[model samples]
Structure formats: structure tokens, C-alpha cells
Target: MSLYRPHKKGTTPSGYRGTVVARERDFTAPTVQLLNPAGVLRPTPEAEPYLPLVEALPDTTLEQFYRDMAISRRIDIAGANLQRQGQLALWVPSHGQEAAQVGSARAARAQDHIFPSYREHIVGMIRGLDPVNILSLLRGATLGGWNPAENGNFHLYTLVLASQTLHATGYAMGIQFDGSVGTGDPETDAAVLVYYGDGSTSQGDANEALVFASSYQTPQVFFIQNNQWAISVPVSRQSRSPLSLRGSGFGMPGVRIDGNDVLVSYAVTRQSLEEARSGAGPSLIEAVTYRMGAHTTADDPTKYRTDAEVAYWAERDPITRYRTWLEGRGASPAFFDEVDAEAADVAADLRRRALSLTAPTREKIFAHVYSEPHPLMAEELAWLDAYESGFEGGAA
Candidate 1:
């Protein structure tokens, strides 16, 4: 039996489960969308100033955007398959989020820092991180595989849910302390971009981070990829209104955009990050997208969602829509074929690296518990060794 079916009218007080939350009124908050699901480009008044920016982007760069989305989907599939094959301890699929992540990541400058909430593989990919680096984490080979300071300022993936918002806010404040903002030097000034899900909007840490960000006027953009479902809890349960409205309450401007459309995602993010970098305080973005796959390798989304809903989103597939737009723009079949071949090569390489990863040794867990060793850590380590040595022929 399907675990999640829509409720009937008058079945509940709010007509949606038994809660008396905000009623679903007229959907007045306009969503910025440049490309429709039919693969046609339609101009929007809110997105006007940014359309020229998209046009000014070189054709090579535009083509690369599509390539990034295609390749990231390949990598996402590889990760999920590797988990099923027991190569990875866990997998967080980014199957349907490539456009939202890739578009925004590309919009940020190289000098800007980024904070990712575990599932942003494409964002990390754009910021000079090899997909293998993330595989090491999911495969239980390392706590963190790459150095954030040296690797294009992409911070380590924070899995604690919404905690990265505080970290991002603090980092943005540090940038301010270091005189990195309002210097009239775009190259030297730095901004921060942090990614989180719609579910996180309800978390205290995320709200607190926004409060701090607003108070300090931090140079940061809070990118919330509202993937509709937060691990089986629909976004409807999280907020009564659009998630972007939360920003206005915190004294920052907010924007809601169609996350599946790469054009809107890229254009909106560029504008928001520019405002932050110019010392105009923080901004919030709610990118309306969907997670086509399960929340994780362990999740069975079929239990909580209907196949019909999934099919509806599949019809609005970001990659498919973008590919259609590209074809209309005369992107040759040869280029598309080449991109497919490149994605296959990337997937193959990732599989090889994922299989080659070695599990971390038990002793390695004690390496970074603290800056200096403590008596408790020493006692635990010694006790662990003694217990393991009791086995026949075990290393002392």
C-alpha cells in the first residue's frame, strides 16, 4: 500500500494532516522562470536585468553548463550504484538537483567561499573538487578528503543539517573583520554561499544564522534548494508560505525561482551574490526543485510519495529541458555526442576510484578528536588495543 496519499477535504482541520498551519491561499509570490518545462525560453519581468548577463556569457561557457549538469548526473548515478554494490557505506544522490547546484556554483566568483550541506556534489565539482574526493567520505575511507583552504575555498561538507548556515555566517563575518568587504575591489572582497534544504528552514540553527546574518549584514547568500520533500516530510509541513519569505522577516531580500531551470537559477544567484559582495547584507534564495530519487541509498521514497508525482517531475527534468533549449540554439549533435562520451568517461573513472578506496583503520579515529590528547582519549585507545589484542594473532 502507498504510505503517502493526499488527504481529503474536511478530513483534517487544515485540510492537510491535523495541523492548523497557514492555509494555502492564492499563490501570489511569483517564481522567476526563464525556461519552461516544454524546453522553451520565456522572458520574465523580474529576470529582465539578468537576461543580458546570460547573453554576454560566452557560448563555450553556456555549453559547459550543460556538460556539468550531464556529467554530474552520471556521477550521481555512479555513487548510488556503487552503494548498492557495497562499495560505498552510504550515498546521497543528486540526480535531480544538478541544475540548481551547478548554476549557482558557476555564478559565484573563485574568491568566494562555499558551504555545502552534504548533497551538493555538483557545487563541489564546479569548485575544483574531484568527485572521488566526496566518494572517500561516503565510502568510509576518510572524514574529509580534500583541503578546503587550498581547494577553491569549498568548505567541507557538513552533514549535521543547517549547522553550516551558522558556519557560513561566521565565515562571512570573518571576511568583514578582515576588511574583505566594501573595499570597492571585487577581486579582493569575498562573499559566502551556503546550501541547505527546505526542511532546514524549520531548524533553529538555520533561523539563528539568518538572525546573525541580518544583524551583522554579512556578505552571504543563503541558497535553499527546496526539493519539495525533506526526507519524506513534504515542504508543506515545514512552512505555510514560500520559504524565501523567511528572508524578508530576517531583514534580507528573498527570491523564489524555478530551480529546474538553469537559466533562472544562474541569473538569480549572480544577482544575489553581487548584492552580498557589495556589502548590501545577506540574501535568501528558494530554488523550487524536486528529488527524483530516494533521499539516500537507504531511503525508499516509493513509501512516502506517489509514482504519479515522480512522473510529473520527470517530465520537467532539468537536463532534458536544457538540452532542448540548447538544440533550439543550434547546439550540434556532435557536441551533444561528445558531452555524453565525456560523461561516460567520468562515470567510469569515478567507479574505479570508489572501488579502490580503503577503509580507514580503527586507530585513525583517534587522530583528530582534539588538538591535544586527553586522558580519556588515551585510556580509550589503550583499552581498545587491549581488547583487540585478545583475538588470536591480532596486532598488539
Candidate 2:
């Protein structure tokens, strides 16, 4: 017998008992949280074990985590500048969600695969992708900077919202098939972490992925960075409730962490990933944060959002809060200066690479369009060659 109790002993609830069953189109979900806006740690009973892990990390490590967020923010800003200067076609900024990306990225094991949305450039850096290569892709010089398999399992950024969730699920299924999980070996048991935004929660692909993950018990974590505004649309317009409850509907535990709190984000993601790798199936993390800057260079958030709302979130800047916490712990001023200098150096190098990038040759674009050359491709290539040869300068 099922453990669930009926809403009524022998009849439906009063509101629906005598009426036809009408499907209500609206429902609200609750946001699960382990930390508050303040820097104080406040973990739930279920999340208590993870607290020790966070506390065990040394002060130096915590400072370095802050540095990662700062450096990444600098890179994001520089990329936006590049776009404005016509060095890039477009640029997506992760200005406010740095803690969410860096904390989770640092928590990932070397064997873990990360499927990310386009805003996860910081995560790419954590996975060993050079910042300049990522800039090159944005500048239209390459499809992507590094191969997925070579970059410590960091996959290419998915431009389509929520599509990478299914890819991550499928990859986790392969991991399960290969018996790469549940061997009690942290070094070998692989897990997958997929990143998305709150706006993507409404996508059919995201919901379907949750269904498949629950049914198959894949070792994956769905990391949703709820940055409040989905481009110009406020999250309230998309759903009345929090996004974490979506995981509960699919029969997996859901937790929310302060995405702005690096400590909480790292601790919770680390714990959830470990659980999944140990055969705990999939989990969902709804990270509560804000996007302080425009979604992209092409977007003007001022049209859709109030200046007051933007100012409010600015006061709670993730990098600033972490720096404050580090200062309280006696971090040296020299260390901060060193990190700032290093970030400047990285940004300068990226700018140089972006300006010097050469466009790929015409032939290079067609070379990988197919695995094996087809008759149609041959004919198209011949036509292009003949057409180009008609010009004063023939095809190179």
C-alpha cells in the first residue's frame, strides 16, 4: 500500500468535492535555503554534514575563491568592453553570479563533467580553459577554445536554454552504464553538474530532463542560478513559486543556497555531487542570486527593470561580501593587491589575443560540416571554387 494519506477520509476536499475536476494552471514553489544574506552560516538539519566541509577549508583557500570571483568578473567586464569596441560580435556577462559559478566549479572533482549555459566562462576557467581561448570564441575566431574531453570534462557552452540538462543526463547515464559510479571511489566515480538559469525552468526540455533523471536515477546535479530577472522579464512573471520545488515534483531532494555566498554554494554543491556519485541519484540546487548587469551587450535592462531594483542587488555584491569576510579573518592587504594585479594581467593578455585573432578560411568552415564527404558537399564545394575562381583573386 502507498504511504500517502488521502486528502479526505472518503471524499475529495471541500473545494473540489462537488465540482468537476478542473486543472489549475498556477502553482507556487518554495525556495529552499541554507544561508541568509548575512555572512553567518545557517545550515538546515539535513545539510549539517556539509558544514564541516566548508569550515575545514583554510582561510587561504577561501581567499583564493574570492580571487577567482574577482578575476572572473574582471574578464566578463573586459569582454563586454570588447563587444562595445567591436572586437566581439556579442558578449554575455556573468557580473553578479560569480560566486555561484566559481564556488560550484571549484567543488567539482576532476572526473566530474560540467554542462554549462553560455554564461559559465568562469567555470570554464576553473576547468583549465584559458581565458583568451574563450574570448576568441566570442570574437568569432573559433567555435570553441578547447575540446570538451581535453578541458577536464567541461563541455561546450550551450546557447539554447536548458538543452544542456538533457545532455548532462545522457552523459551521466553513460557513466552509470560503464559502472563508473557507486564504487565508493571518489577518484573514479564520476558525476555530472549542469548549469542553467531561473528563466530556463519554464522550458519543456528542462522539465523532461527532470523526468528522465528521476526515472533512471542518474548521478547528476541540476544547478540553477536564479538571478531574479530573465533578461528583461522578471522571474515573478514566469512563475509564482520558487524553482527548487520543481525537483521535488520529480521525486528528488531539492536545496537552495545563497548563490552570493561562496561558502554555502561550494559546500552544498560539493555535498550534493558526492551524494550523486555515491548512487544517490540526481539532486537539484536553486541558487538565489541576482544579475547586476545587463544580460548581454545587446540587452538594455533599464527598459524592463527599475533602477532601484538594480541598486538594491548591487549592495549585496558577491565579491564585496566575500572580501569583507576575508578581511575580518585577517587576510593581508598585500594579498588583495597581488590578486588585483594578477587579474589585470589576465585581462590584458585576453585583450591582446582577441585583437590578433584571424578569421578562419572559407574551406575550414566546410571541412567539419560532415563526418564523411558526400556527393552533395563535393558538388557544392566545386561550385564555390568555380564561382570564386571567376574573381580577379581566386579562392585560396
Candidate 3:
């Protein structure tokens, strides 16, 4: 089970010896929540200002959020199955965190650059990535070979934790230096949206990124999907307080929100990204959600997690919770049925394609190690060929 505690009022900030005026999301209110676990539209008072943004969204955009979550859940299940069937080396599950990903990805504009952690398959899809491309990485066919510029600027995933934070901050700084931000032009102003996880917050890279982003006031958003557990380690074991508070400690706004509520995720991220692109500097968002599955296909959640905890989070499953809200908003049953059918088709297609994926030639490894041909690569290629030819029955 995950151990999470909301930051209480008047709790003096600790650890820092400097003049620390803690600027938490709220002194009393809990995380930002709009939809209850039961799919009821009970917005927290702190979320009132963002309701207008949600209300202004077109019907199609709103429904697309639910569709994305549903499809993501399906793709996650398929990926896990593929790993179990020995088609892939590993699979990262993103089941319970769909709302957080879908909402945040949709919030970013086309010109915005997105730096993602490895588990953000849904986010990549939202940014125009083919889901099959994600499977290719686990299958060892390529090293995240997708071109970001051609794929809605969705950068390749970084399996190394928290490194993307620095990459994103640097990119945001470049945007600032290039005069691409705060131009009052909605279409051209670009910001950076980077996703990391709870565990990454403990990394030096993440902290350094936050420091640089704040010092430069970079056009970036540091999105932390606090999924309660970083692998088997409960979040409580990682830090003494809420992760969002790190924003204030770094001179930026920190927000904790109900990550299971797609609406809250969308609204909060949308506003934060707009603030970033407008040159208001960077902010942090900690989405308090749950990881309803193992950390990866190589993990066994039954070893550390509890059934009751899983049940509790399952009750608030992002896809179903958002579906209930969509239904309440007069979304027709036909639309939901269509979404389910499409999800199945997508999963089936991925499975077929994944199975058909052939192993790349040995030479494939030497193809793109360098942007330009290097003497070292040529030497290594020659050695590899000679070594292979020396094997029994091998060609000269």
C-alpha cells in the first residue's frame, strides 16, 4: 500500500537553513481534485478558477481525453502480454496513470517540445507517435529511433531517470534565448513539457534541473507523476513531505492534483504550460495517482503491494472514472462503444505487428552511432565482420 499524507497547515518547512517562505499549493486544501472516485463532479474550491477552462473545451476535445485513456489502458495490457509471451525484453505498465498522461499531453501545443520518461507511451501517442514504435524499443530492434521533429516534437524516452529534466530545462533555456517565448503570439511561442516520476525527484539531476529552470526562468514545466510507489519503495519512504513542495523550495509554484481525474490533470497542466510559454518561469506539478500494476514486466507487485490498496485505486481507475464523467456530460453510449472497439483493434494490430518484427542485421548497430561516418565505426564494423566470419560454417 502507498503511504501519502497531505501537507498540513502551519507545518514549518524543515531541512533548509535559509530564509524559506514555503509556498505550498494551499495551506489547508488537499490536492486539486475535480472528479471524485465515483465520477462525481465535485470540484475542490482550489480548482474553481480552472473550471472555466474545462467548460470552454469543445465536446470533441473532452471526449478525446477519455478515448486516449481507454486506448492507453488497452495498449498497456497488450504490452504486458507481449512481454509475458516473450516477444519483448520488458514492458512498463502505465495503467492507473492514464489520466495524468493523457491530460498533460493534450495540454501541450504542437510547437511545444515534450521530453518524456520511459513509461510515457500514451504521451508519445498523443504527440503523434505510433504505438508500435514503443514496442520496438523493448523488442531491441532499435534504440528509440523515432525522429522527434517529424513526430510532433515528442523526444525519445529516457530510461535513465531524471536526465530528461535537465535536457528539457536546457531546451527551454534555448527557447528563452532564441526569443521564442513571451512573444504574445500563441502559435509560435514554445515551451517545454517534461515528465518524470516520484523516484526521479530524489535524483540530483532533477534537483539541478529545477535549480537551473528557476534561475533562468525557463519556459518549462516539471511534471512529476507521483504514482505513490517508485518501484517497491512507497513514496513515504522517499521523502518526508509532499513532492510538490519542492517547487516552492526552488522558487516556483508547486501543485498536487488528483491524477486520476483527467479534467484536473488537463486544466492544471494547460494553465501551467501557458504560464511557461508566456515566460512566467517554470512550475512543478505532482500528480497523486497510483500504479495499479508492476513497475515493469520483470517485477512482481504481489511481493510488495496489497490487495486492498489495489482495490482502492481500482475503484478510482482513471479510464472508468473519466468515462462516467463523459456519460454525465451527455456523451452518447455509441461514442463509448466506438472507443472500446477501436482500442481492441489497436491492441490487436500492435500484437500482430510486434510478432512479425524481424531481428535487425548485425550491421544495424553500426548504422547510426554517429551523425557522420567515423573512422572508429568503420574499424569496429570491420572487426565485427571478421570475428563473425571466423565462426564455424561462417562466410569469409
Candidate 4:
């Protein structure tokens, strides 16, 4: 029998049992969309001012956007496969949210800092992180861990939901304290961009971060990728109000955008970060998008959502819609073909590398416990060694 099936009647309210999706509230926030579902280059009225930003982009940069999305999907696929094949402990797929990740990631200036809630693999890769590091983490082989300074200021992922909001806010405050923001010099000025999910909005840490971020007028942008469902729970069940309003509630401007539209994501984030770095204070952006896959390798989305809903989103796949726009731009078939070939290569290489990663040593766990060595850690390591040495032919 299948482990996860749709709920019939008379079951409990939870995954693997039954669900009661009380969509008592619906969010109908107006969103800025530069590209429609048909891949047309028409912008909504709200997106008019930002049209020039997209137009001003060189063809090469535009092409890079598509490349990044394509490659991210390939790597995401590889991650899922690795998890299923028992090569990875778990996998968090960013399957359907490519445009939002790519566009927003590209919008940040080199001087800015970013904090990602796990699942933003592409965002880290864009900030000069090797995808192998991500795979290594999943493969249970990370030792010292990645350094943000060496990786374009992209901080490591915080697995705790909504915790990164505070981390990002704290960093922004540090930037302010150092007089790195509002200096009127774009090159020297910096800001913070933090990514969180729709569900995280309900977390106390997220709201508290907002409180501090707004009160201090921190140089930061709160980018909420509202992908409809926060894990298996719908956003409507959590809040009747539009998430964009969250900005206004916190004394900041809130803007909603079509997260699937790369143009909208890039233009709006670029403008928000600019204003932030220039000392205009913080802002909130609600990127309305969807996660077309299971929440994680362990999840079964089919158990909670319907087939029709999946079909509807599949029609609006970010990669497919973006490719349509690129085609309208007269991109050659060879360019697309080359991208596909490269994506295939990337996926294959990731699988090969992921399999090669060895497990981390026990000593590595104690190494990062503190900046300076601790006597307790040394004693514990010795105890662990003696305990393991009791086993036959053990290195301990």
C-alpha cells in the first residue's frame, strides 16, 4: 500500500492521516508582473516604472538569468535523485521557484549581505559558492563549513525556520553601526537581503526581526517568497491579510510581485536594495510564487494537494515561461541547446561529486564548538575516543 494517500473522511488533521484545509481567508494582493503566463513582455501598471530597468539590461545579462535558472533546476533534480539513491541524508528541492531565486540573487550588489533559509541553493551559488559545498553538506561531509567572506557575503543557511531574519537584521544593524549604509556612496554602502518562506511569517522570530529592523531603520530587504503553501499548510489558514501589508504594519513599505516573473523580481529587488543602502530604511517584498515539488525529500505533496492544482502551476513553470520570453527576444536554438547540454553536465558532475564525499570525522564536531578550545570539549573527545576504542579494531 502507498505510504501517503489523499484523506478520505473521519481522519485526523495532519499529514499521513487527514487534512482540514480551512481556507477561510483568501489573499488577493495585487502583484507587479513584468511577464505574463504566456511569456509576453507586457508589464502590469504597477510594473511600469521598472520596465526601463529590465530594458536597460544587456542581452548577455538576460541570458545569464535563464542559464542560472536552468542550471539550478538541473542541480535540484540531481539533489532529489541523490537523496532517493541514499547518497544524501535529505534534499530540499527548489524545483519550481527558479525565477524568484535567480532574479533576486542577481539583484544584490557585491557589498551586500544575504541570509538564506535553507532551500535557496541557487542563491548561494550565485554569490560565488560552489554547489559542491551544498552537496557536501547534504552528503554529511562538511568539516569547517563555508565562510561568507570568501563566498561573496552569502551567509550559510539557517535550518531553523525564520531564524535568519534576525541574523540578517543583526548584520544590517552592524552595517549601520559601521556607517556602511546611507553614505551616499553606492560602492561603499551595503544592505542585507534575507529570504524566508510564507509559513515563516507566522514565526515569532520573523515578526520580532521585523520589529527591530523597522525601529532601527536598518538597511535590509525582507524578501518573503510566498509560495502559497508553507510546507503543507496554506497561507490563508495562517493570515487573512495580505503578506505585503506586513511591511506597512512594521513601518516599512511592502510591495508584492509575481515571483515567477524574473524581470519583476530583479527590478524590484534592485530598487529596494538601492534605497536601503542609500539610507531610505528597510522594505518588505512578497514574491508570490509556488513550490511545485514536495516540501522536502521526505514529503509527499500529493497527499495534501490536488492534481489540478499541480497542473495549474506546471502550466506556469518559471523556466518554461521565461524561455518563452527569451524566444520572443530572438534567442537562437543553439544557445538554448548549449544551455541544456551544460545543465545535463552539471547534474552529472554533481552526482559524481556527491557520491565521492566522505563522512566527517567526530573531531570535526568539537572543532567548531567555540572560537577558543574548551577543556570540556577535550575531555569529551577523550571519553568518546576511549568509548570507541572499546570496539574491535577501532581508530579511537
Candidate 5:
């Protein structure tokens, strides 16, 4: 019998003796897709409404989108190389999840806010964040590169896993209170897109964020990148069902997309964000992708995973797949070559900037500790100066 077949009620199977094997029901989830891995346009009937949005995107813009993924991947690879060479303090590789990050980020409007986990550098890049600024955060030069208020509403990368989910929900609630959404003007209305990983789904904060989002019907989208492995633990260890199903339990619609397929990711995120901005409640999107490299520079995948697994994911590299799709769609070879060159140039510049970064001075840390200066901060600075003066160099 098939493992997924239903068991008869009150009847035991031959292998179980007296116990019965529970039925495995198929998942009934709504996934809005526009493109498959082979670059074919086989959209579902439900996805038809969003075709105009997809077709409206210019070919030049699509080429740029390809460039974004390519450059981001190059930067990620360089960062990994730096980590291996003992330059960076730590590096989180978003190797195989570029399509999900880049596509979803591009789908958001300028007014929308984004809350990201630490590995969303690609999203930050799409929001016009300086590459060097992002490096400063990884190198421990600053808490985060730019203020959210001035950086296209993109919040700082939260290292505490799913903590950003609550932050996003709170921001969404504030948006509702301020009457910034459901204004019928897509350009002016605001929404929230918060990103997390499969590992963070197990956190209490993530669950609570979903609860509050549902209760208030906030205009937000919870973007979960289910990269198969949460550090050393496989996703199977976290839950038996897909992560998107968690949204159903919270009374919200959920979607699953091929995260490695950039077109699908962009199309689905665009639809979801538009729905949220147009008075719909929160939605959860689970992007099924993989992390082809180690979780972080400090991690050793060899200890917990097999080489065959890494090689398996490598074959499905997001950048490569997207490039193949673009090429198949009559994209010129010259365009591909130009993008490759541009990516290389960007990587070179980033490497130079990272290597030439200067460490902040002693007083620099105290500059932004508080908006207004306080006596306690003055006292602390004075003490730090005295403590440093006691060293052999008598300087910090």
C-alpha cells in the first residue's frame, strides 16, 4: 500500500497487528506561480489575474533583475572567501536563496517596510543600501549600516532569529493606527514584509507575531525562506508538515513557491504585497529553497551533512537557473556577458572597500548611544579614556 494512502476507520493494518497507520492527506495550499524551473509559462488559473503585472515588467528591467541576483551572488561568494581567509568575523551565506530574497525585495513598493534576519543582505542591496555599509555590520564595525527611517524603511538585520517578526507586526499595527494603508493608492499605502528562516519558525516570537497579525488583520507578509537546513538540524526535525501551513492555523492564507525560481518568487510576492496593501490581512509565504553552502563561515556542514547533499543543492543554484531562464527567453548573449562583467566589477570594488575599512575610534561608540547626551555617558567615556591610558601605548 502507498504510504500516503488513508487507513480504514477502526481497522488495523497487517504490519500494525492491533495499531492503525494514520491517513496522510494531501496539502491543500494556494500557490500563485508564473514560471517554472524550465522557464515555461504555465501559470495556474488563480494566477491569471497577476499576468498583467508580470508582463508589464520591461525586458530591460528583467535584465537588471538578473544582474541584481548575479551581483548579490558574487558578493556572497566573496564574503565567504573573506571568511575563509580570516578577514571577516562571520559570514552567512545566502548562496542558493538569492531568487527568493532578490525577487521579493524587488516586488515591494517604496513605501513598504521590511524586517530582515541577518542573512538578507541581498534585500538590503535592492533597497539601495551601500554594499560597504552592509559589510560594516558583518565586520562588527556598527550595529547596522543605515537607520531604517532614512533607508527606504528597511529595518536593521535582527540577529535574534524571529524577533524581527514581532517588530514587523508592531510596525504594521502602527501603520494601521496612522491610517497609512488601504488608501486605494498603491503608491502611498504602506505594507510590511518580514523575512525569517525555517529555524526561526520554531521560536515563540514568530508564533506570537502571527497571532497578533491575525488578531489585528495587519497589512503584512511573513516571508519564510525554508532552506531545508536550520544550521545543523534538518527541517524535518522541526516539523512534519511544510512551514507555510502554520499560517492556516493562524487563520490566514499561505503560499509555497519555488524560491530558486526568481520569476515565481517576484510574481507571488508582488501579488501578496498588493493584496495586503489593498486591505487584506497578513499572508505567509514559504519559499522552498536550499542553502548550498555552510550556514555560516563558523559552521562546518561536513560534520552534520553529507557531501552528496551539498552537491545536490549546488546543481539547483538560483543564479544559474535564472540565467538559463533568461537566456532561453531570447535574452542576448551580450546582455549576459555585460551582467557578468558588472558583477565582477562590483565584487572587486566590495573587496577593496572591505579591506580598506577603518576601525572606529574610542569615542565613536559613545556618539550614538543616546539621542541626547547624558551625564552617565560622559562619565563612562571618561573612565574608558583613563582605562585605555593605563595601557603601554596610553591610547585607544
Candidate 6:
């Protein structure tokens, strides 16, 4: 017999359900989903107001959203395969969160600055950074690739949990000081979007960043992609209520959205970002998505999570649902075939680029840390050189 009692057919699973704000057509309750899982373009009560924005998107842009999400998923899968094949030192998979990443990323305008919390590969790609730029880091070729200023204002990936939140806040403050926010010029005025995970919310740096953002009224959005797992720790163990409520305590508005629905993600993020840019202060978004894979190539999800949980999320696959909606809207099979072909080409290119990457030299690590020579660094370099000289393959 099953240990747990099953809920009704339309209700969410026990642990995943939140306070019902409003019911959808299917009678389920949880985060906001503009498009239902069945691929119908049904807007929830919270998302109804944004229907015009969603409808305003040109057909080409809507198609691009699907293409971008498809390509990103391919890139993520390729990254994992490369790691398993020993081509990459480690890989962070954003498997089921493509809708969350791509939707919010596509919402940003060119002048908007983005700060990513390591796994936002799709976001980085949307901001014009080469996908290989991220792979190069995982391949141990460089600390980071692509200059943020030149590469569409997308910052380097921050692996240290929640540290990027502070960096993003500081940058947003600078944007404010420079009279960028609320300038009434969309082209010149800028806002910042920073991503972190649910686990990062518990970090002091993230809370501190929120305090500063609220205090200074910085034009920014703190996007928390609550993927339900902090390494091996479930979000239920970390917080009592929704992660979104944490921002409200800091005087910033917070909204929890169904991260699996691309439409809601795009609309909400676009709305939040616009509010921030217009000097309405910062906003927080808790995207309720599932990781759908091991946290990284080094992790083993089977050890902590159950197969049933995985299967549950699998049924709500963002790509498949979006494809259904697109088809219902008269999207041709030829278009999907073309997207598939493009995804294949992107995967091939990524594989080629990843394999081509060369590991950084030992001495190169000593550079970039300090602007001027320091005694401790010099001594360390000397020690490294002397230590290496003892090996048969030591460099001169």
C-alpha cells in the first residue's frame, strides 16, 4: 500500500501546494500560470492584466521565444553529456528551468544589466554572451569569458551563493546615482536584474542586499529561481512560507509565479523590471520551478529525491507544453522541424568549442588578482614555480 494518501485529481501534490490565491480553469491552486499545463492560453487572475502585453508580442518574437528555449535546453543537455564524457570539469544543468530563465531573460531590453547566479545559461545567452563563454569556465580554461560591458551588460557568473546579489545592488545604486533610473528615456534609463536560488535566500549576503536595495530604492529585480533543491536540501526544510514573502519584509514587493509557464514568467518579470526602471524601487520574484536534474554533474539526485517527484515534474515539462500551445495557435510543423535542426547545430557547435578549449596555464592563475605586484603574490608565484620544478614535466 502507498504510505501517503493521494489528493484529488486536480489538486497539487501535498508538499508542493501553496496557499490558493485563485483557481484556474482546471481547479488547481498554486503559483500563477498564464498558460495551463495542457497548452491552453488561459490566463490566471493575477496574469489577466498582462494579456495585452502577451498579445502585443509579434509572431516572430513569440516564435523566437520557443526557439531560444529549445536551443537552451539542447545546450544544457550537451553540457551534461560533455561533463559525463570528461570534457568539462563540472557541469551545472538547468534542465527543467529553461522557461524560467528564457522567459525573464527575453523580457529584458538591451540596456538592462543582468547578474546571473551561475546556472542561468539561457539568460546569459539571451544577453548576447556566447554559450561557449560559460562552457569555457566549466572546462577550466578561464575564470570567466566575455567582458560584461561589451557583451550586452551581462555580468560574469557568480558561483559563490548569493554574493552576486550584493554586486547587483551596488551596480543598481550606481545606475541611480548616474541619474539613469526614471529618466523618462527608455533607451538611456536602466534597471538591473539579478538571479539567485532559493538556498541563497537564507544567506546573509542576499538579505543584506535586499536591505540595501530597499533602503536606497535601487532600480533592480531580485529574481529567485526557487528550483526546490539547494544541492540536496529541499526548500521545505529551509523556509516555512513561500520564498517570495522574504522580500516583502525588506519593503520590496514579491510575487510567486509558476516558473514552468513561459508566458507568466515573461509577463511578470517584464512588469517587475519596468516598475523598477521607473524608480518604483526593487521587486522580488520567486519563480517556482523544479531543477529536474542533479544540481551539478557531481551531484546524485537519486540519493535525496524520489522517482515519483521527478515523474510529477516531467509531466509538466515546459517545452512540451509550450510546443502544444504553439501548435494549437497554428504553428506549422515545419517551424518546429527548423527549430529542432537549429538546436542540433547549436549542440554540435558547443561540442566543437568545448573540446577546443585549452586549460589555463598554472602561472596564469597568479595574474588578474591584483592591479600591482604584491609581496605575498610574488612569494606564492615563486613557491609555485619552485614546487613545479621538482616534477619531470616542469616548465622553465
Q: Which candidate is the best by lDDT?
A: 3
Prediction 2 global C-alpha lDDT: 0.85
In candidate 3, stretches whose alpha carbon ends up further than 4 angstroms from where it belongs are 1-29, 390-396
Cα-lDDT of candidate 6: 0.90
Q: How accurate is candidate 4 locally (lDDT)?
A: 0.91
Give one digit per residue, the lDDT tens place, for model 5 in 58-120.
Answer: 997788779888888899888988777777889889888999998899999999999999888
Query: Candidate 5: misplaced stretches above 4 Å?
Result: 1-33, 44-49, 390-393
**Tens-digit per-residue lDDT, 266-346, candidate 4:** 999999999999999999999988999989899998888999998998888888999999999899999999999999998
TM-score of model 1 relative to the true fold?
Answer: 0.91
**lDDT per residue (tens digit) for residues 1-396 in model 2:** 986656864466443556456888676543333444554456656557667888889877788798899889889878999999999988999999998999899999999999999999989988988777777778887786678898889998888899999999999999988999999998999999999999998999999999999999999999999999889888887667677777899999887777887877898899889989999999999988998888889999889889898888888788887877677678889889999999888888888888888887667666767899778777887788789889997863
| For model 5, the run of ten residues with the poorest summed lDDT | 11-20
For residues 304-339, could you state the per-residue lDDT of candidate 1 as single tens digits?
A: 999999999999999999999999999999999999
C-alpha RMSD in Å of predicted model 5 compared with the true structure:
6.0
Please state the error at residue 395 of candidate 3 in Å: 5.1
TM-scores of the candidates are: 0.91, 0.90, 0.91, 0.92, 0.90, 0.89
Q: What are the per-model numbers of colliding residue pairs?
A: 0, 2, 0, 0, 0, 0
Better of 2 and 3 by lDDT: 3
lDDT per prediction?
A: 0.91, 0.85, 0.91, 0.91, 0.86, 0.90
Of candidates 6 and 2, the better by lDDT: 6
lDDT of 3 by residue, 1-396 (tens): 645554445453442345556676433326998888898888999888888888899999998998898899999989999999999999999989999999999999999999999999999999999888889999999998599999999999899899999999999999999999999899999999999999999999999999999999999999999998889999877777888889999999999999999999999999999999998999999999999999998888899989999999999898888888888989999999999999999999999999998888888879888899899999998999999899997756
Q: Which 10 consecutive positions of candidate 3 have the poorest summed lDDT?
A: 8-17
Candidate 3, overall lDDT? Answer: 0.91
Q: In model 5, which residue pairs have backbone atoms overlapping below 3 Å? A: none
Candidates 1 and 5, the one with greater lDDT:
1
The TM-score of candidate 3 is 0.91
RMSD of each: 7.5, 6.3, 7.9, 9.6, 6.0, 9.3
- lDDT at position 315, candidate 5: 73
lDDT of 6 by residue, 1-396 (tens): 988787776576665655677744332224777888888898878788878888899989889889988998898889999999999899999999988998899889899999999999888888888889889888888888879998889999998899999999999999999999897898888899999999999999999999999999999999999999999999977787888888778998888898998888899999999998899999999999999999999999999999999999998888999999999999999999999999989999989988987777777878868999888888898899998988998876
Clashes by residue pair, model 2: 29-241, 29-242
lDDT at 355, model 2? 88
